[model samples]
Target: MVSAQPHRVGAELWGQLEPNAGLIILEGSSRKYPYIDAEALVWGGAGATQLGSSDNDATFEALVMTIKVRDPRGVSDTRLGRFMLSTGAVRAMHIDGGHLMLRARSKTHFEVFGGVPVDGNIEGRKYDWMVGGRVSQGLGNKGMIGASYYNRFNAGQRSAAEAGGAAALRGASWVDPSAKISWELVNPGLAEVLGTISAQTASRVIRGELYVTKRSPTRMLQSTSLFTVLGDPGTLAAGGNLRWRAAPRLDLWVNGALQDAQDDFGWSGYLRGVLRLDDDGKGSILGELRRQQVATSSWTGLRLASVIPLYEDHDTTVGLMPEFEIIFPDHPEPNQGNVWPWGRLALRWQPTKSWAVAAAVEASANQIERYDVRALARVSYQGQWPKK
Candidate 1:
């Protein structure tokens, strides 16, 4: 057995090890300038690298260095530095840049941002810069409607350009249902739309979401990618998900999706259920069944997992969990059987809100190997000041 331990390399650095994987992360976040409206975040690994780097070029993988300032009265917010973008006008991306958001007393808001595009592939995508913006107007007291624009460039050549509109409604009342239709529309040329509704009655709660997505590699992918070679066939996909809390401690979820690509429709979906054994919800059992039909293959998968409290020492709490999964491929794999199986047993301990340690043994049989087994351990910690 390997002694997988957690180490503190610095005041705010945390590290964890597991046989073939190692991570040393440095992170810190704080509020300053009268202490509430100014903030900066730093997160990276060992020489400030990534979580797990096995390639030479990834020695110093990536880092997040950003500072943010907000107006005390909520008039404006600004940020500068290197960070990852969230799901917005375009796909989420890591870049170096600046952002500004302004709110007017008239219930109007505006956002503008510009930066450089970045990813894992080194020396790829001769990207020089990118910029985007959004503007929205509030509708009475329920929701808001907005539109956005985004564009990217490759040195001297424009790589992509897209535009879209969006509208949202929450706590909607039947008296005014005008703003509740066709939720979001972004980049209709290669756009996406999503909307969700929820209802609750006593011990049961239900939520449903519908989405549509369209993508074209010719306009979205980098020029150097093989996707450009395939031209712009485009893809349209629709999917829906339903989540229900049937009881105080039981939950069920179902999801189904269909994709339109290359003159055909492909389908995929899954059903999952979970039950809690205790009121605190620390112990639970879960099972899931999935059916996947893609362009290249079709298969059915099953998964079962459970966790239960085992031992407690002083302030520390320990638990045991066993998980199993298997997949049945319609056809035999290359030199392998038609079935693949995997299992794992884990023991975990949590002594405080900031620290957790887990040791696990996993065994599997797949096309890559007839039978492979491994034992591993991991430790993690998080710290916060002025605990609020």
Candidate 2:
């Protein structure tokens, strides 16, 4: 009891570097016995200076550190520090703020949060605070309806006042629909609506997913900058997908989407199939055919990928993965060829329970360059103190 179990701790690290520069990211968490946990994460790059010298300035930022607490009775909870909040139809927002949730006895819950935008490009600090709230009520059994509102200023100007509503059906065997609508209260008054319906057969051999989205792209930016003038009316898209289990080891899918925009009318789709080579499914291969067209540009592509298990045991495993893609562009770029192809082969080894290493090489031709190749190696570890 006095030894404290050797102060147990586990960590994982991974990054891609060399020939092609990349960043390293770290994430860790700590917890106590009662009901509190704290976590921090950081990721940044080592890059050349502004003047383009040989020396590299490395930067790793710890932008997130948060703690959460909840009442034992499950009636209320709160989160403090930096975290991401995504409510109702609102996309995820990364802010340094706190969130509170209260659930009443009548199957209704309310949530509220406020925070300042935590980003590098945010210019003004005085008018950067953001706030939003959501309220939801559960239906008799397997459904709920919710409404949310968000407001904030950016660059010392009134940027947005967004309101959204959503309704969904949960835990249903047949087709279920979830729909959301959001509107912006700014001058142009942008609005959006999206819906999804999914179904699966009782035998679970076939499935279907359908969705449609109509939204204004300009809503992504609420700044007072002149760039906002570049936004147009809106875009509408409708898509559906079907999944079929062709055999005990084979699955197939077909999906496509159509878009109608003022500048471009286009559609994109893919047909894919995967065959399991072994019982574990790790030794599997996938093939896909994809095609897309917009305005005056269009292309058809073929992709093939496979995973091969070389060695496997209780504590260690070795694997090989290879992928290739070829695209035939109707109209090629200025310098690149009409046919674009890229291929990669990788081998990975996990020597022990928590140690892993992988090496790969790839070659590709793109609009910027033709006939280029590169190689990379990476290692990662996940282990706990006292030998787990």
If scored against the real structure, what TM-score would every candidate get?
0.77, 0.85
Superposed Cα deviation of residue 243, candidate 2 (Å)? 1.0
lDDT of 1: 0.66
Tens-place lDDT per residue, model 1, 206-273, is 76666666656465565545566666676777788888988888999999989877767799999999
Backbone clash total, candidate 2: 0
Off by over 4 Å in 2: 1-10, 18-34, 48-55, 120-127, 188-190, 352-355, 371-388
Candidate 2 lDDT over 1-388, as tens digits, reads 1222322233434443433333343333332332444556555445533322234766555556777776655577788898887778676888889988888888798999888877725455456778889999978568989999888777667787788899998667677889999888774555688999999998879999999999887775675656668865788889999999899889999999998887588998999999999766979999999999866769999999999999999978999999999999998967789899999999999999767888888999877667778776766655444543
Provide the lDDT at 12 for model 2: 38
Candidate 2: pairs in clash: none
| Candidate 2 root-mean-square deviation in Å | 4.3
**CA lDDT, candidate 2, residue 2:** 20
CA-lDDT, candidates in order: 0.66, 0.77
Model 1, runs deviating above 4 Å? 1-19, 34-58, 120-124, 138-141, 171-188, 191-204, 223-226, 229-231, 312-315, 371-376, 385-388
Best model number under TM-score: 2
Angstrom error at residue 295, model 2 = 3.2
Output the number of the lDDT-best candidate: 2
- Which pairs of residues clash in candidate 1, taking residues 3 or more apart in a chain or in different chains? 45-49, 164-187
